[model samples]
Target chain A: MKAVERVDQFYLLKQLPKATALLCKEGNLLDASCSWLEIFGLPPINKKQKTQIFSLLPEVEDLIEKLQEAKSFNLRHEISLNNETRHLKSYFAPWFDEKENVIGTIVQTDDITSEVEKEEELNWLKNIMETKMEVSKTGWWEYEIDTEKLTWCKETKRIHQVPDCYEPTVIEAIEFYKSGYSQNKVSMLFHKAITDYQSYDTKVMIVTFNGEERWVRITGKPFIKEGKVAKIFGTIKDIHNQVIAEHRVKEHQQLLTTLVDSLPLNVYVKDLESRKVLVNKGECSYLHKKPEELIGKTDFDLYDREIAQISREEDIQVMKHLTPIIGKETVSCLNGKTTHFLTSKIPYFDLEGKVCGVIGMGLDITSMKKKQEELCDLIKITSMQNQKLISFAHIVSHNLRSHSANFSMLLGFLNSEKDQEERKRIIKMLTQASDNLLETLGNLNQVLDINTQESETKKTLNLKKSITGVLHNLSAFLENNDTQIINNVADDMVVKCVPTYLDSIILNLVSNAVKYKSPGRPPIITINAIKSDKGVLLSISDNGLGMDLDRYGDKIFGMYKTFHNREDAKGFGLYLIKNQIEAMGGSITVQSEVDKGTTFNVYFNEES
Target chain B: MCILMKKVSCIFIVDDDPITVFGIKKMLKSVADCKDIQIFQNGKEAYDALIERQNLGKPIPEVIFLDINMPIMDGWDFLDEMIELNITEHVVINMITSSIDPLDYKKWADFKDRCPYILNFKNKPIFKIEPNDLGCITAAS
Candidate 1:
């Protein structure tokens, strides 16, 4: 039996290569495989005396009893040798005789250290990948075009609110996209990627399995194999929070743009370099350009040199002073219309409290300015009319008072006189007083006539003919005074005036020249009319007893203002002539000296 | 009546109106026992006559009635010229006016400051002389 067992052991050892070992019933080391010796760093066994296995490996001594009792036993053990630990699996089986009684044991050992280390490293890698995917809400996807199979990572499944083990078909995956543009767009992109090997990177809206809306960003890449499109892979990121925040920011910006455009006033922003950075609708229209054209341009590019210089200087001042400047700016448009603006320029500052540019706003005030000027002109005319009315009141008071006084004096004389000759003289004096009273009334009536007459009575008349007619009417008085009248006026010179006023004006001026003649020298009157841009300038000059103008310049055209001591100085002729000339839209001015001469220049409007 | 008893040596009436001059002369003749009376048509004529009298070594009038508002030089101008004449005689002047203009009174007050010889500023139509008017003139002279 022992010989047959030895032969069986030797055959089993030879067949099992380096992993098998044999032991006797006494627990002694018999034969070891080549692999076992190599793993434990042991020397080859010799055939001198049988070796106990305990002495070879002391750690396996406890297992020897179990190995002796059981039919077959297996054990995993760690042994330390040469400062290194090694793991080994040992199996012991009893060798059987023909009578079924155990003779010896067969032992086998395997070096399993590398296999355990590999399994631990694989577990650590799997744990790290799952944690990364959970924190970032990022996942990967793959689509096999041939099989129409789709695969999604754990994070991707979470994003879609699906079970972890769920496998989606290509069509089912695309259905997760919201039904409108997102679904169509994703489907089209999937097909295009597979057929054309195209890559896509875009944001898309998706509806999850639970019917919750979410925003996601997908980046796709196509793979081609054997000259045919095979697979599509990409990353689908859950970017709901980022996309919503960005959308809200865009909405706020659009609202601000609309508010600025709605303002009627011109609003603009300019950079430090005087380049326009932003402009509203009003500003764009004011510049006669679109907003796109105006932005990035300057005042120098949009306006004339003079206007641009004014705007640039104001902007620079506001920025430099870091304060607002408000003022009026007049701009003349290309159509020759002028507009006035009340413009304000304020300095704009950056986050660091530095003046970066200027912000400008302008309000149009052209109509208001025009109305103010018209009001001023109206006030002037009303005041002038009030002065004339006051003067008229004074004339009525003085002239009427003087005439009544004369009548009373004459009546007193007639009542007291007793002598026949004195009585006759007093009667004559009364008659003369009545005549003078009647004459004064006639003169007052004529003044009233001129005052009430409308300007519609004015007509163009020959200036020379008017003067000649007056000279003819006063020829007798002129000859008696030895007055020489020179009418140097052109025969065809016309003046816009009322015919009656023209006749009266000429008569009064000529009569005055003759009446106020100097006692020392005969009067020489010169009448001349010269054509000017405004109208005809008719000047009547006289070498007579001219009064001092300094003392009577303001009073020369006042009623009852007499400068000279003359018998018939009624002080009404020049006053009436001034009123007539002014009524015809003309003006009269007088220059005089104490005894040298006097010149009266009358200016008439060309159209009137 | 008092003027009828007191005799004025020489009286001058200066006025532009011939009727007024004649009436004043007649009233004076009836009131006083005086023959030396002179009349001037205006202030300019009166001034010339006074100057001529001074040059001829004649007696200047003691009482002169001057009318304001005349054709030539008025009463104010006559008074301005009278200051330059350097008249040494004591003469009483009666200024007269036809109208009741307050401006004429204001002018008289200014002239009276320079020429204190003016004794009275009387209104026109002196139909009858009051005894007080003659008494004041005689007292001032």
Candidate 2:
């Protein structure tokens, strides 16, 4: 090996800033720069002594062997010089002789400590950015207006379902959006942002390369240079999942609204303040207002003060108790008509179990209430008729039994009689008893006829004329009894009544007055008629022996209730008259006093 | 069909129906042996006569056949008046009426507690003198 030219190597090594060194083929250090000595903390080498490179830096032992086995260039490694660690780039090249034969090798070393650390930090930062973009489903893009070049990041390519090396044009990028609204929206925004130097953030629907539709949010900003729009850059985010969830929520809300609006009942939701939040069609029509107009208004705004106060109190009770309140309410309409409703109010709760409002539901029950009242009235009438039937039976039995008993007694007398005259008298009594039995049966049959037959057919008859006809019919009896008949009814007064019932009623009244006359005073009968709203009031009053009403008020109209001792008093006259009046949809009431007079007020219903 | 019982003096028949009174008088003639027989149209007449006889210090009727359902005063009213008058005489009163009404029977039963003079309650149609009925009145006297 030729002698190494240390002077020339020292000059060349001094030109470089890093630590530089040269070693021989035997791996001994031939020359090193002053900076290298300073780095390794080594003293200057003497001319006669040899120091091996591996001994000076033990970290380079494997590197020296690699250089010896094969000629390597620029192989890098790290070594500790002195007590500090430094990273170095090494080169091992052989020097050639004139015959082009292998001579000694040149080992060049460079300290690259700062450069290595900087490159490692750059690589770490790049790794973090890539991971963040993948996790967030985000991508970025840039467009150069002059060159019309579109550049996309690695993440942007993945979002479009494109190959990593694929280059996209501005038109190709716009085509990725769904064809109609989404596509047009993006185009318009893009042009506007460029010309106006505006920035936009929007969500758009895009069809990927694989023909799958996806939702993306694009945020774009345009660069203005020299007072003119130049370039555009933006980010695209995949927001498919978020958009779908929002759409489902909207659809569910619409379904609930439709269900509430179509119910037949009056359905409403009110807030804690008693303000209406929601109302159905029934409530809207009932209030004579539209849903939009009624919303946010309280009952006070739609109803009178009295009704509104009641409604508000009910709502407050529901929320305060957190329970349902059910009751009946009467609502009067604007036309002065009243309606009844069966209403229920329930406390509405939020997701957190707080009572936030009340829900009111009501069903109109006015017609049902009316029907119930009518049913009660029918029951009362039925019970009254039943009582009358029981009384009639008892009267018939008593009258018949009395007559039969008298007949039996007379027959016994006749059988035991020894004298012919006595036997003849007994026979006459038996005949009289049988006649009384027949008469009682006839009266009972007349009473039964009034109960069974309908007397609905009515004819207009003059009141005075009808009374006169009845008086004429009973003229013989009236004259014999010396009864005075005074008809006070108006000549022109007309009444709606059945012809037979009217005649029977007047005749019975007149005969009763004559039959029950006081012994000292002659019977004076006064028949009067007056027109009233309840049809016509016909009063038949007599100055004859009037009964003591207090003693027999309840039984005055009962069958066989005789107040006087007259032999002809069958006691069926007043009973028959009352029944006949009632059968023709009329009522009869009597006012009487002992030895004074009796007045019968018959109220006939007007024919409709 | 005469009832051979002890003789009863001052027998009274009070009724509203003349036929009922005739029937009772005829039946009593066969059933009882009485010295004096008096007839009254209603309870009021009988009651007034009894009160008059008591006031005059005379003997009242020993037996009375009273009928119900009279015009001026019924059998119940006479009995009530008899109790108020405080008649000490031992009169045997029998209520005879054609009425089959159970109410009359119930009212008589209730009155039995107030007036012990009521001897028996008999239904009408006393066709002949029943020895058994006359015996009851005679035994009570």
Candidate 3:
């Protein structure tokens, strides 16, 4: 060894392996260990030259004050080496001479670059985890079974509104769960976790340290060591806002359900397929079904087929147009009894305002409809009575006045005549006129009695039975007249009418047929029934004698008007029958031709 | 039958009512004509007789007292037949009616507009007519 190297520490530092250096106050390198020289890209010690330390580490100049500190200090700074960024931490202690005067810094650096980078990455991950816990309103808590200690994270402390320095015990932590169900439940679960190593997840309400109530999700897991629970750690999430919103939604749903269920009318919600999705009490009762039985059923299942078809079509129309059908009167029948409903339906919209179904309400109006029908029948009967009175007045003036006029004319001739024989002849003509008046009065009386018979309840009579009975009575007369009778009335054909009036009507028509049998041919009278909207139409057609209907059509049903000149043609028969039919709310019409045939089409009240 | 002295050579008393027809026949013979008074029960028989007379070249009644209300055919129907057959060149129809019905008056008015052989539209009972009234009656056109 050189004699100077034995006393010089710088020369002795030359052989050190770690990066150690001696630097002056101006941040210039004085002596550096070989490892330091090698790491900083310097030459070996034997051929070393003074190198500028600040050139490679210009940022190190800011740490020069750290190098001069009396005790010891460390500094970290960045350097670029071989196009790679690296961090270095250097420790500096004051260098002293024998006289105790500071000269420069003895700097020892370690490539702590990897250590600083690892520490920086760890700090970044820790920051991210804390921020995530804060954002999610989640916090952790741990319980040590043996120590009976509970420790809370910063987020958990914040959730409980506890002071930062507060320490918690297991009993105090469980007390945070609001008393009763929440507190009791958590206590049981905590006991179970400690004893049986069970895991638990539950939602509970808690009272914070600040005396505010809150909802939270509590979860726990037990860690076992050697068949014994070491600790139980879990998350407690602040779920206050979410739980409150859910509570509001549940309340609203309950309110709507209660309101719809209480309505007396038939309220229903139908889906796009017109199936009953919801029905109120009234609808269930009207259909005679329970809610469970009625839900998911269609109108066709509850109503008659024809009525169901109409209801479904209306539902479709409402949904398609997105328009409401308000207060339309509809009819329903059950067990042969009819009911009326004032129904309204509106399109049921989804959240998007699209018509997804129909909501309908039906109000019972059967009694109101019945009253309206009664009013209509009253009006009809009043009009019919008025018609009867008018006809009565006209017949009295026309027929009776003519009779009185003849009496006056004959009485005047009897007084003016000079011969007794002519006077006697006038007296006999006067007697005949009086007899005609009496007969006219009797006919009018019978016509007036039609009102009484009409007031009686009508009965359903089979047309075939009535026709057969009449034909049996007329069999002898028909045989004498050589009349061919064709009774074509169906056996099931029925009409509602007064019995005696029907008998008289049949007798009058049949007698007229036989009385007016054709001189050239035997009479052919056909009686048939056909269904009509008004009722069963009985057609009594004859081939005996047909008058010129075109000329005398207006007077065919007139009092004392005859279409045939037969001696027995009373002319009052058709008029009487017409009055009877009109009083009973039926009608009669005739079609005839000269010398062809006459057909009397009579309509009776429909059987109820 | 025809008579030279009777004002109407053959007068027809067509009525459904016997009393009315008897009174008219007696009055026509006593006040209007002396003989050849023809009687019919209704307008249908009256119309048939007129058609028969026209077909057989017999003398048609000079004056037909036709009643408005009759069976099978009425006075209006008889007049319709008369107008259709064109046989009223020399005959006159006196429409007799007891109808106070306005419809009858309207119908008579309608026939008056259509026919030239309407002599008169009279009320019931020709017993009130005098011989001078019958002489004054004549066809309007």
Candidate 4:
């Protein structure tokens, strides 16, 4: 090459990104391209001049020895030239005349710093991603609309658990997702973004290289260029844990909501700043409004001023204590009525341990309190019964013992009298006293006998059988009273009762009917049974001498209280019958009038 | 006492009340011939006497007037004790009490299987007897 043309070629080479140089056998520069100067960032050099290349570029001395050992040799190596080592490729051969031999070594020095730096940055990013176990990286890939190029970021390969060395075609990458729904959805998303230039966000599962199924969220955005789709890009995120956590949170929230709604108690919560009310279903009715209506509204808007003020004060107290408070409060409604609530207010805390609002749960205790009062009344009645029984025992002992003592004393006097006539008269008086004593003893024994029958051993009995037994036993009495009996008792009706007590009850009622027949008409007795939800109702009605119900209905069951004066009528029979029936968990009621018939309804609890 | 033992066999009277026992014992003197007339206040004491005598190989009483109304142990309790020991069934047992309850009669009537040993239900005193006076023997087998 001639020297004049060499300068022009060297100038043109300086603008190239690659460096160039030429060296003679002595390691001096016979000629060097401008790229060499520019690579070292030095000034331009003169043409056709032998220069000391080592002095200018001290790092080139090691490269010269390597080049001399082999002819037509090429090598890539690094050297420290400007405080930083840069890689260079060199070619070496022997000089020849008109033959293919290297006259001097032609070394191409490339700065390659940018390329190496980019590779190092990529490796650093790879190591950071590989070590990150908590924040998993996901990726997506795309291709240009009209180009044969495919592009994927490192995160994209990682999301599919593919190695960095894996190079995939566009179609192959699309096939990595599950083949059915996922493949269809991804295909649709790609087609729509490419054709319509639309943006899409979707979630899908993909089978990774490691054979693990993973859920990823993809957000795709397309760019349009010249009315034609240019490129599409998207981001994929592992969102698996977040998705699972969100789903579990949703289920728990629904369960808690259902539990709160199903509870009989009223539950409500309010936001302090917004003054919005949130309530369970039961609490909605208590407010006389729907839950939606109550939402975004304060208690003052829906309730009376007193109620709102009291509720707000209660909420403030709850917030101050940061605990629950339980008590009773009267909530006045706009309807002009106040309801008593067994109320509990609690402060709800946010994640930062700050009180967000107050929650209140209440139970309406109006009916329960009424029932408690009734139970107290029953207790009082039981106490009165106990007192009455004690008094009865005392009366029996006093009256019977006194009469017996008088009879014994009279008999002793009769025995002491020596005069025959006076003894006879005294004996007669003693006999009369003894008879009175015996009568008193009988009455007392009858009363005490109830104590024995008080224990009602229950058994399942057919109503018809029991009534039939009573009728058969009272056949003679019914005939004597000339009474006609009509029985409409349900034959299959079964009741749980003490058999003996049931017999006695039936007999007493039937006999009463027969004895108290109306004077003008034959005594017609009706015995009917009805099955009700309460239990079996037994009604015994008689067209006999009925007393004025208004006057004696209240006292008919009282002890020693008799309305009829039949010779065999003992006032105590009906009284004992009523007590016996009541003690067996049954009740008795009588309806009668002065000239009309009497009907006694016996209600006994049915056995399940 | 030897002549009295010769004149009558032993008769045991069991009752709770002292007056009733005394009256029954006094009235029994006129009704039957008896040598040994023993009296016990309650069924427990009477049972003990019978057991003690039987253990000594002495014959138990041929006739026993058992009072149904006694505290701690009554005539039924005595009978139960006797039956458990397999006492002689030929010996007559009469339940004597002043209780005139129809339920008591019903209970006694229903117990006919154990009644051959029980001769009758008798009222107290045993003083008066008439041909049709079922009063002395309320029920008899």
Candidate 5:
């Protein structure tokens, strides 16, 4: 039997796999594979050599005593020889003789250096990934649908403020979401991702283990195996601050919209191209359209071409200059009615401080404008009354003082005169002066009556009819004087004045024209009138003897001052007519040249 | 009585009111030494006669009684013309008038500063004037 076993051992040792060895109980080598010798960098075995395996490979010598119990050992160990290190794996088992007594060890060895090095590299990568997740406040989660297991990463547990020993079920994970909308929405998305093999990303609110509320962004992606979803996993991020900022921005936009819509004045915003971008309720109502319809429309689209053209040019100027145009008054005539507005426009800027558009506001001021016009008219009337009062005072003092002084002087002369004839002469003079004074007083009284009376009761009358009536009354006299009357006043021309005053004004002007007839030609009187901005301008021109205006300009309207030598020149006609015209809110102006004709322009305030 | 009457070369009275002019003329008769006394109904008439006399190389008026209010031209206008013609330096002007306004005296006060020809101002109705009152019109005291 020994012979047979020896042969088996020789064959087995020769044909053993690589790095195999056999050892006696004392760790002496009985046999070794050629690969084993090569692995330890040993020379080939000789027939005279007696070697133990522990002497060849001392790294596993400590396993010799452990094999005395006849137990098997599998180990990983380190070996160094000739300054070269290697990782080694060894399996040891005791062999038994025929009588069942243990003798030596048969050990198998493997060099597993590459696998251990690869495992260390993988651990380094996992460490870096966990660190990154913690810093970003990000964590991952996985739900195994089959086992109903929920696994959370360490950072995920930190986010929930839970202990590391805490492990949650699928239902418990769903409960972490806030009770109402967040829970329902996350649950629905989770189920959908499971059954439909879909992916989802959403923001939801959660109640943590500590009862603190937070906003988080959850993304889910399903992992399908064999066409069935096994697990769903995604990232969860703490987005509380970003989400709160977004909500505040939305609220601010809504507040501005409400504020703009509440104002009664027209407010609108326009883009760089002058297209309306936003409009308030007031602006929409002004255009008689809804806000949606008014937006993107320009001034040219809403107003008359002439009116809008001006406004567009102004807007362009404002944008180009990057300055504001405020409180511009404008007038619009539409549907036979006039409207006034006070408008303002300002340049609006972008985030970069570049002028982007214009914001405009306007207020209706038509009624205010009407009130201002009425105020102006009132002021005119008051000033005119004050001027009349001053003139009356001067006239009264001047006429009375001169006449009284003359009377006193004449009486003084009479008292000193001894000759009866001289006395008689002085008395005659006194009587004549008294008559002159009485007539002067009567004329002054007439002027005083016209001045003191309130604005006369005015009636609208046709200028052509009034002029024709005056010409008719003086027709016979005009014919005797060889005069020709030219009435050019239009039939549509109308003026507001007291009726008798109108008749008297025409009569006085026409008679004066005939009275001052040039000796070289027959008198030619022409009357014309046209509507003017100031009022109705009536021009009565005459081809008659004209006085030197420069010499008599100041006295042309003075009482009791006559320029011409005519015997009938009373010098009261112009002054009386002036007072009458002023009482009715009218004015008269004359243009004349010596030896030429004359023209009188009478402006009468138009009737409202 | 021994004091000799101050004599003027020629005197001009400008007034629109004839009664006042008549009274002034009668009073001037006391100045026997005066060469001539001219009368005009208005300022323009007086100014025109002055120009005519200047052209004729006749004696210019040594004194003139100017009235404030008148037709055609007024005392102020005549004074401006005299200043414009550079002839005011040769005449003594008395702004004689019937105006009783205090404002009129204020105006004369302002004019008196610039116009040396305005020697005196008197009110109207000089019927009881003493002969000594004619001294203001004399060319020599």
Candidate 6:
């Protein structure tokens, strides 16, 4: 019986697949396999007493009882050993001896942990693949170029709205693309892939299994084997949303292009390196060239060296920063005229907010700049005249006050005096002072009248007629001075000037000639007006006692300036004559020599 | 009944015009009570005489007639120097001129703050005095 029990233990241990075992008798383990020793947390290839195994694995008694209950009984059971976390599947059977007597129970266990882990991994992989197909909404296809065999993933079949078992050949795949350019394109692409191993990426419309049209983007790469086409694999993507978005963007760009080109101000955009990428019609016109000529060129190509250098520096500044710069500068056009322009340059940026290039716009402001300067000059002149007028007012007031006060005081003294002789003396002196004051006031009034008179209401008047009238008015003076008149004036030459001013100007010139007649010789006056396209050129030359040009050239027409002594020469006439001519937009000039003849030349505007 | 009073002692006329000085002296003799009167034709001549009299221990003129509107020097210029020189402490100065300018009137009215030095203003040699006049004998012996 003891030998049979030992044989039973060895048989159980040999039958187990890498399992531990123990031999037991009378509710105690007698011997065990080396694996059994290790299973019980003992050293390798070492055995322990059955009593120790029975104490550690309390369920061993139950397995023994079940083993004794039936002949050749086979049962599988789980046993816990020493509270460890490993599960053991044990096969139990009754042991037999050499005499074929039932002696003890035998148990065997095999670990199945790795097989379970592989099954879990396969399930996880299937879940991940299914989730990917659902999320990406993508499908893939492979084509065997030599065999013309095509395979589609399940998701690909679903995307085509077809059944799971559907199979399509290369010809069918090409036919699946709609007829027309799509079919042609696919045929060429597939032929290229087979012969030349060229890949293709394109969008095409297709009819699905449900008879519905849909847009798809197909990308392909060919597999080459031994320098021969083997197979082609690619992806089919549903990019309908992206295609629509791109179409809208193209439409918006077309509208914006039209609007920018129509603007009067020149507008242009540069690329990533400040090279001209876009130019509008107005911008091209400034260069005297077409838009195509300006493209791919920078400012240095279009502008002169100095201007281009300045503009390029500004463009570089904008490209290096995110701020906008605006400046006004003059640009020399092809016509050689400098045009003032207000320029604005701003940085262009990509969506990531990095500096890309610059966009510049220029508004032509040449006329506006000229007008502003003219207005400033007019303001300066007006203010200067205003200062002179204020001073004139003060002087007039002071002089007039002094004279009036003296007159009033003289009147008071005359009234208070009773002595006949003294009153007579005072009256005579007052009369002389009043006469001088009257003369001064009269001169002032004459200048003021000429300055205030408006010449805008002038009409076309015959210059010869006005000059003749002046000669007639001054006939007595000329006769008294024994002045000889030499008239070679144009007969009907007309000019645009106030008639009264023309008469006054001629009268003053003739009278001055007569008044300054030489003492030794009679004055000889020559009057002539030459008619030309510009205007009538009137000259009045006098062989009189003329003054020195060096001394009187600047002050020849100044008010209260008298060169010769004549009782009626108040010196206000020439000044008034000059003022009148200027008010009518005419010019007067004089040439003189001391003790020689003087000549007055006048230019009058001719009406168109 | 009024007690008799002595006439004004010396009358001095300071003016640039000799003719105006002669006219004033003749008119003053005809119009006002006068005794011995002396006339100086300019501020410098008049200022020197007053200072010399002070040195000689003689009484200064009782009446001095000053004129503005003169060449080289005038009445107001004389008053400025006279105050500095202290030439006359007891004499009365009367400004007389042909200048009827209101600005001149206002200027002289303000200038009268150096009173007794510039006592009053009259129109030239007419010698008309108002009720406000602080009358001192203009010419006396």
Task: Identify the leading candidate in terms of TM-score.
Answer: 2
Off by over 4 Å in 3: A1-19, A22-46, A60-71, A95-104, A110-392, A415-418, A460-496, A522-543, A548-555, A585-604, B1-6, B56-60, B87-92, B124-127, B130-141
Candidate 3 per-residue C-alpha lDDT over B33-115 given as tens digits, one digit per residue, 9 for 90 to 100: 54677788887788888889888997777677788878877788788887888764566677877777788888888888988
Tens-digit per-residue lDDT, B1-141, candidate 6:
322333566767786544456456644653446676777655666777878887898777767778764323457767777777665456667787655567778877887775546478776434334222225433424
The model with the greatest lDDT is: 3
User: Candidate 2, which segments miss by more than 4 Å at Cα?
Assistant: A1-265, A269-277, A284-324, A329-334, A346-358, A411-420, A474-494, A517-535, B10-18, B34-59, B70-74, B97-102, B124-141
Listed in order, each prediction's TM-score against the native is 0.62, 0.65, 0.64, 0.41, 0.64, 0.46
lDDT of 6 by residue, A1-608 (tens): 66666566576654454654444444345445656555555543223422533455555566545645744443333444566444445555556679966666555555444554577799999788767866887778998866768998787787678899999877777777788987898788878877787899989876788886777888788988898878899777676678788889998998999889998888999976668988998888788888788889977787787878788888887787767888756465555778888889999888998877888889989889899999998897688558546645754664465456556656766777898998887787677658867977986786677667653467888777777788888888788888889889767777788778788888889888877878879999999888777787889999888887775576577554455544566557887777677656677999988778899998886652
Model 5 lDDT per residue over A310-344, tens place:
87887888899988989999875544566788988
Docking class of 2: acceptable
Q: Which residue pairs of candidate 4 clash?
A: A139-A156, A516-A545, A547-A593, B8-B35
lDDT of 1 at A59: 69
Q: Taking the tens digit of each residue's C-alpha lDDT, what string does model 2 give over B42-134?
A: 677888898888889878787788887765567887888888988777777788877788899999988888785745788876776554444
TM-score head-to-head 1 vs 3, winner: 3
Candidates' C-alpha lDDT: 0.79, 0.81, 0.81, 0.71, 0.81, 0.71
TM-score of 4: 0.41
Rank all candidate structures by their DockQ, best first, as comma-separated numbers: 3, 2, 5, 1, 6, 4
Positional deviation of A189 in candidate 3, in angstroms? 19
- Please list the residue runs of candidate 4 whose C-alpha ends up more than 4 Å from where it truly belongs after superposition: A1-140, A147-149, A178-180, A194-198, A221-231, A272-276, A285-288, A296-311, A327-341, A364-370, A420-608, B1-141
Model 1 CA lDDT for position A320: 89
Q: Pick the candidate with the highest DockQ.
A: 3
TM-score of 2: 0.65
Candidates 3 and 6: which is better by lDDT? 3
lDDT of 4 by residue, B21-104 (tens): 544554455455677878886777888998898899887787787877553356676777887878753576667665555555
Task: Output the better candidate (5/6) by DockQ.
Answer: 5
